[model samples]
Target: MKKVLILSTALTSVAMAASAEEISVMSWGGAYATSQIEAYHKPFTAQTGVSVINVDADNPAAPIKAQVEAGNVTIDVVDLEYADAVRMCDEGLLEPIDPAILPAGADGTPAADDFLPGAVAECFVATIVFSTLYAFDESKFPENPPTTIADFFDTAKYPGKRGMRKGAKVNLEMALMADGVPAGEVYALLETPEGVDRAFAKLDTIKNDMIWWEAGAQPPQLLADGEVVMTTGYNGRFFAAAVAEGKPFKQVFDGQVYEYDGYAIPKGAPNMERAKEFIVFASQTQQLADQAKWIAYGPARKSSGPLVGLYQDGKTEMGPFMPTAAANLTNALPSSYEFWVDRDAELNERFNAWLAQ
Candidate 1:
């Protein structure tokens, strides 16, 4: 149960007064975002007298569209991918935020600079940074396991079936990286004809072992069920899985792609004032640090707390299975979101054609 006194919990009366009227927060279900809501959002409501209406959706887009189309600005706040937020805002589906109303202390409001530089945007601030890594069950590979995407393809060496996300960005980047292009060069490679072709050619090698994961939840489920020894998805899902089930699976962040999830207010939100309050309440730096413990997603505010890296109590979570460790985070390659955002539709067309071929 949350402490009933909002003013006492956050050291502010602003949030306390706002909580009386409920604001709805839309997010993916399961332990993924619930932990943050419970630890952060719930407390925010309790102290401020605000009632937060939580909305859960497997695919959040349809409902957001429906809500907006229905002329119901019921979804006062949206926690969604940056791309969707940008698109929605471009479509006049989002509202600009006034940061002044966001909770602030003597030091001023926790600004975008407080977050990962990648997560800040015109109308949306990235709430977290999530990465996808190659994970393997340690016991399945007593000695040699896939360390990099190249190894993931080295069926001769790490010969179990491999898993990759059905999604395009990370998969494309990994294919290019595995084809011997340097990590830094992966994006530029796709910019050229040869690089794009090279990625598909490389992908052909393990296409048979590949299982296309639709939801972000599937890859981790694959690992848990022993369907495939290695797979990729949000590093948090796999990490949280291991933490939740005490599974033997591991994640390797080496050359993983990370993306910034943003906190956006829909355009013409009915409760615009309250939405701003929610964003401020959601991003308290201390709460971010606490959230990292429950969700593998790291704080956009890097200053939060000691995030689990490759080690827990001095043990390394590295190798092929774990991506959240510091060592893996250090070496991991990330996707070019700007490139993907710009060319994804074209790339998707070409990729689909290639898949058919």
Candidate 2:
């Protein structure tokens, strides 16, 4: 009888292990992924007994499209930029996510009303509002640090290597801004052919001095390694290096372009229902607010704001560091998703041609 009981227990153990479910999530790595792992993945796993696997990419959107088009979808949930999310949804590459699945805010507000404008879309639910901004190593410019977007392009003044993302999106807008275009008028100017030429013209000035980086984590590393004096990067990575790791990096918010980053399930995700459940859990007010504790990005849900307090360090407040903070928005530009969605391919093609030249 004891032998029989042991056999039954072993079989049960194997069955339970086999039944355990796991979902793969693809996101931009570095401090950003750490934030999600702590605030969303850990708690979600604890609550549901489902394992969460993280996959890192320079950008999640391309791999998602590739996997879906090839009809061998491996990633269950993917973090996406606002423009990519909208573009993919339009192409029917993402599964439709009903806002009804999200829970009400901690303050008892409904999900639809609680989420900031454009946070909830047909196939995407935004989790945080992040920004792309340039930061310089203070040690690199001890006397007169760069204070404006124009300084980023003034290779003659700054006189050092600069790091920039290997993409056209934020670079074009910043080029226009550095060339003296107002934040509100950037997209309008880009709509004209002359304006496109002007933006590219500005970029040409610093082309030789620029060290192109494609990954979110590369900027901070480049600055630390002294590969570049200044680099445009996501704000949170810089925050982690400076405040958390005691790096001498300082961020310049002038000409910053802020936008939303969110989660979506690819069409035909193997674990579609479970992926939906994970998104619902991650987008809740508390989870969103908790994410702010680890990174500087603002929570997308309005109710999540009040819950955002000190950073993980326990003393540093997160409000002033957020891209949406009042002080930071003085010359900041909200990235126009519509403009990118419409012009992405055309501009990128031109950008690639320019790069070749």
Candidate 3:
């Protein structure tokens, strides 16, 4: 950080933000957005004297998906979503991570085995354990809390309108759980007629109370305004609101479905040599923890949480975010991009039609 530099999108460097070569990070764009580019990559440059630039993480403008498809990958580091990570790996758009290159610093972090199970199960490791929970305005539901996905659907017990994400991949697993399936059996059931049918049947029970959300901000607003007493929301989004902004809202991760969004080098990154260095540096446990502090999404390395002890300045971590919290793994969902990719069209069609009912 001694010889660092700083700069805004349209401005030049200010201080402690310098780096030899700038790394372009792919992520969302907005004012309150906690993009990896802005939070992790940008501050990393300021702190470690490394530099990173911001770019669109999704397709269309300088798209990573299209470029990877065209046999030329320009993005050095990518933030991969559930299926996106798997899709890139299968298509040879990601390079394998070699931890040996990324040595732990003075903190004795970057220790292996810290990442969540779903991430280690995949080639690309976890950067953040993002979850979808039934969030509510505590003021309205002062006497009650929604714990499980089943409670999410039960308007009788909960007794209020609900907001639902339109996307089916995560919701399907959730729907299955609400229908009385356990976490271990979610995927197994999806593989059978009974599982898929049971989930849809449960969803049909609350179709009337459901208000479809089109974007990430939709559910939060739907909750903040009391439009719906409870709704499915991303942990980071609610973390920003409830914890960071001190909003009177609470999120129940008891039956939450957690998803990982983290770094994966393109199969043939133009700057493979430099890309590898960035990956190793970014994956350092504390660095992941530092990034997590800004978002409240748990880091890949378990050491990050206990070692860093750096809570995001304002956010309150949901009980489940703690490594030893009382989490409801029984109803948790691990979205399989592979399965969704294959059955997306058919499954989504079936699920979306059911949502309309």
Q: Give the top-scoring candidate (lDDT).
A: 2
What's model 1's lDDT at 89? Answer: 67
Residue-by-residue lDDT tens digits, candidate 1, 214-323: 56677778877778878877787777677666888777766687777757887667678778877877776666665665666767665563443332323533323333
lDDT tens string, model 2, 152-228? 99988898999999989999999999999999999999999999999999999999898999999999999999999
Which lDDT tens digits does candidate 3 get at residues 4-92? 43325324532213333666666554322454655566656776565676665322223776777788766777766756676666656
Measured over all alpha carbons after superposition, the RMSD of each candidate to the real structure, in angstroms, is 7.5, 3.6, 7.1
Query: Model 3: which ten-residue window has the lowest total lDDT?
Result: 10-19
**TM per prediction:** 0.82, 0.95, 0.78
Candidate 2 stretches with Cα past 4 Å from truth are 1-20
Q: What overall lDDT, based on C-alpha atoms, would model 2 receive against the true structure?
A: 0.95
The predicted structure with the larger TM-score, 1 or 2, is 2
lDDT value, residue 117 of candidate 2: 95
Superposed by TM-score, candidate 1 places the C-alpha of residue 65 at a distance from the truth, in angstroms, of 4.1
On TM-score, the candidate that comes out on top is 2
